[model samples]
Target chain A: MALKGNLSDFSIIQLLNLITLAKKTGALYIESSSKSARLIFREGKLVYATAGMDAMPLIKIMARSKLIPSSMAASLSERYRSLNDMELGITLINSGYLTQDQIFTGITDFFKDIIRGLFTLTDGLFHFEAEEPPPLTSIPLRMTLEDIIIEGSRQAHEHEDLKSEIPSLDVALKFAERPGVNIRDINLNAEEWRVISYVSPKNSIKQIAVVAKLNDFQIRRVVYNLLQAGLVELIRLNNPAAPAPPRMIPARNPVEQRNLVNRVIDRIKTI
Target chain B: MQTQTVKIVVTGPFNAGKTELIRSVSEIEVVNTEKKVTSESEKVKNSTTVAMDFGRITVDNDLVLFLFGTPGQKRFDFMWEILSEGMLGFIVLVDSTRPETFREARGILETFRAYAPTPYIVVANKQDLTDAWSLEDIRVALRLDSAIKLLPCTAKKKSSVKTVLLELLYAILEELDSAKS
Candidate 1:
């Protein structure tokens, strides 16, 4: 029987467990207006996964993490594009650029990032279509579902904790030094310092995401880490709903107030 | 003269038509953060507003109305408090056919009152539905104050939604007049 239902009714995590435990081969499709994702399984193990444009570039992340040189990663991507059937990891291994262990580690980190994003989706429609054998991406990484789900769950929990501390994604951020400390004295990695340079009290988290050319989740994670390290501060905008402290001087006389109300009522009558 | 922007908060229990009311009356395309309904929320609506819904209408050259629709689920209760901050007034929409949600509607009313203490009206929505409760019945079930106006409106109709806003503005004017005296 084909399995189809809302993610709310059956969580993605639980769905993954079911498919893996059953040792089934198929593709699971999940869609929401904001995002769509797919997970392919072969003999109950997750083989490939993708999520819209948010499927982050593994090479970029690897370069940022200092796992490989940016120039080398870019060159490898160009070379991989030219090949017809050669897989990226195999190509890198054959060229002696990265060892097999390094390629596998990079794959695990890349897939983990995508899985973490999928777990944040609380609402979406999902369906499982059985197949004789699942389709594979150019360089599909084979990993145990057990390990992926466990690590994804840990990342999901950490995401929730960060959200609690950084409540509104709309809140603005700015660089702030702790009391009696020199800002220049603090050590910062190239990426962390680059993100901090864009921090302005006027720039909301959403704006920061754009300026930094990173997705919302990645930018939020960076901001949360910076906050924990005492290198940044979140600026909560004054609630626009709060009643203004009684006006020092009335803006209008009673007659003016009445006239304004009348005009407003008259205009709404036409609506 | 300065153009006065008035912020009005629309709040209610799940599936009470807060989004519909704003969509009906807003002049501009509304900005809403809605996602597929998951968990227990699926028992009601197919999708739910997560963050907030925003819309705007100009009520003459000098005055503008900003409508904010708060998320319904209790998990988003913090959002209710956040959106209601600095609101000049609020509207509590109760689904006339869903009496079970009246308790939640009352709780939303109380939360807004605690935060703003401003003029408000209870909108008895879905009046077009045959199974909907009468205005008086809704008033009693919600235990509304006599001074509080109970307005029967079908949130999907533009005219009906406008009437609700007019009544709310009238109530605000009355409060201001009384305060001045």
Candidate 2:
């Protein structure tokens, strides 16, 4: 029904490559028939991605949440049809139906779930291989496994702490995903995956973070990377657990971990 | 030879001296409006540059600079690239007073940083203020890219401001020189 060379026709890796080559700084919004997808770019590096519908009706469910007027909801829904969520949020905020923070929050949640859903729908199999360097001469960006683990460990622990507060992982599982090669190549220390494994649940991110005793921001990222590589599906208990990404076993102590963050920060400062 | 004029943009966080720098250099007519913004149900984007500020300076009546200032707040950030297209380079004015702003500045910088590695200069503006930080201090605090040149300037002074702009042009010239090699 569509031309072959358009953005949707490209494979995930192809999409990533296109993004790198263009080095354009804009969000890419892609929809396939009934479904929609969004990816954000900062310069050449791929920062964020999402796929699936924004559950618009849930905003009315919050106990203390103000009841959104049917008129406003209907109007905003119309806007989403015409614009991507980022634009939609801005429009709705400008229209005074939603606050900027409110919409930003919605966008954040929407991206997370959309990303989770992205895991199940993705078809392309190519991924960053750990043992072997990415089959390219130049590195696309510095989002390597170390960054992943640092991000992942924090998330895993958050899941453990927030488990009971939110729904289970089943709802959290949305995006179609695959594992990146870095997970397999880097040897994760015991502490890292131990936290990651705990939060690999079938509900909301809260469940995994609470159960794993981890950080929310970091957990979201670990799960995000896992989903990217197709290692896990967003569907709750839809499939078996993914083999945790490789990490340097015998986890580093907290002191050592602090040093790593400092080291990375130091390197960036020098740059 | 016909003189060519190029538009150069000055942008970054609030109080990055975008307006002051423009006033110090342009031979005539510059506009600046200061407003204190309030928050609402949404994150109130405090930096209000509601419109583009224009300043003109004829360089040897050739290589003229048409300076455009953009809103520094995040909500208005979308206008950056739209304003930056086909420009020779941009001067990212840095406020040495507020270190917390460097992170926000970096975020903004990363969005537009495609090439011309030296197409920017870290003008540590407002250097003449009391208890003001030094250029190297701002440099380390901002975790600025090691590759770019850092300049200290008090945009309130014409010579100091012009010197910074000249340095930025030289940086571009140096990059162009290297590219030729």
Candidate 3:
């Protein structure tokens, strides 16, 4: 049976960590509304990855990496279009057009880029088919997943912080009423300025993101930076019903609460 | 003689040893609503808590403490909100050996925090395992606040469970003291 779950329940970082720790060989397939990706792991190490229907061919990657010339890459791709990535790589090596190290390094970087792009996907359905082999048309390289996991973890932390700071994109942004620092004194980048132009009480952060072509992370990050600089403030268009505050000890008396806690402490110490 | 009950919730992701923590410390037999693992994804354990786990400790003739463990799966998140009501404090348990659950643990922590402004501590359980992550790494993975206490714990051990409870009680005491001043 395959392991299946929503990305919201088990994030990509968690899935990678689990696979690495369990040393499971599998192919993880993830699909969102607009995109799909497949990552192949052999004995818990990443071997291959392809995003969408068409993955950038291995020869193109090698040429882009300066391992081979673009003209040679085009000719080789046309000549060996019938061959799989691994076969083409072997052909290149045997023909003295590329070395084993060059092919491996080039393909490894390409795989890393695909994985990094996958990290940005927040919502998707994923399934891992155990012992499933990589497609014969792809190159498989033995690459440890630790570095990618660490990088993904860092990004996840930053994303969480940004989400916490700006819990909703529906909230609009307005210029600070009392700007302690002059807007002119602070230097803003072109993207920041573009976002600023869209800042209004009527325009929500989500609306600005759509107009500016920024994703959730990008908009949240820009808003967070602006808020931190005291250049903007969030204005809620609709008042959200607040959750009930946590009920502390029912006893309103501080002394009673203290006594109760102390007693519990003493009892727990003995146990 | 009069007795009062103080509720402290124990919650975490599935298989994070929440039941073990309560069983190790509860004076009475724990009242658990655990069901068999029907889902293939959760086959790591034979059973999973469906509703909640209830346990108690007698703190002398006048005071008692109640420990409620919430179900670990997200489908039962409503139980977390219900179990967290009118509590003195709470404990979040994490399976130290499983980094995959760290993200789930963070989500649980955030939900509980949203429910109330109460004192809480994070317990890194299964510390006895050779592959257990260090407290610092767990701290980073969970992005826990520096002020929040992250204690090493072996939930199966009575002493370790007691220490975790004591630390939480101490935090509660400190909060009450601060409120008084």
Q: Per-model TM-score of chain A alone?
A: 0.51, 0.27, 0.76
Q: What's the residue-level lDDT of A217 in candidate 1?
A: 58
DockQ comparison, 1 vs 2, better candidate = 1
The superposed Cα distance between candidate 1 and the true structure at residue A193, in angstroms, equals: 61
> How far does residue B102 in candidate 1 sit from its true spot (Å)?
0.5
Candidate 1 wrongly placed segments (more than 4 Å): A1-260
Backbone clash pairs for candidate 3 read: none
Candidate 2 lDDT tens digits, A196-269: 56543445656766676544444555665555455555555445565333221123343543333333223223
Question: How well does each candidate reproduce the native contacts, as fnat?
Answer: 0.21, 0.00, 0.43
The DockQ value obtained for model 1 is 0.11
Q: State the lDDT of candidate 1 residue by residue for A126-235, as single tens digits.
A: 77777834343345667777886677667667766777777676888776656235566767776576688878887888787777766555677888778877778888
Which ranking of candidates, highest DockQ first?
A: 3, 1, 2
Winner on lDDT between 2 and 3 is: 3
Model 3 agreement with the true structure over A92-169: per-residue lDDT tens digits: 889999889999899888888888888887778887777888777676578999999999999988988999999999
What C-alpha lDDT do the candidate models reach, one value each?
Answer: 0.75, 0.54, 0.85
Error of 2 at B128 (Å): 2.4
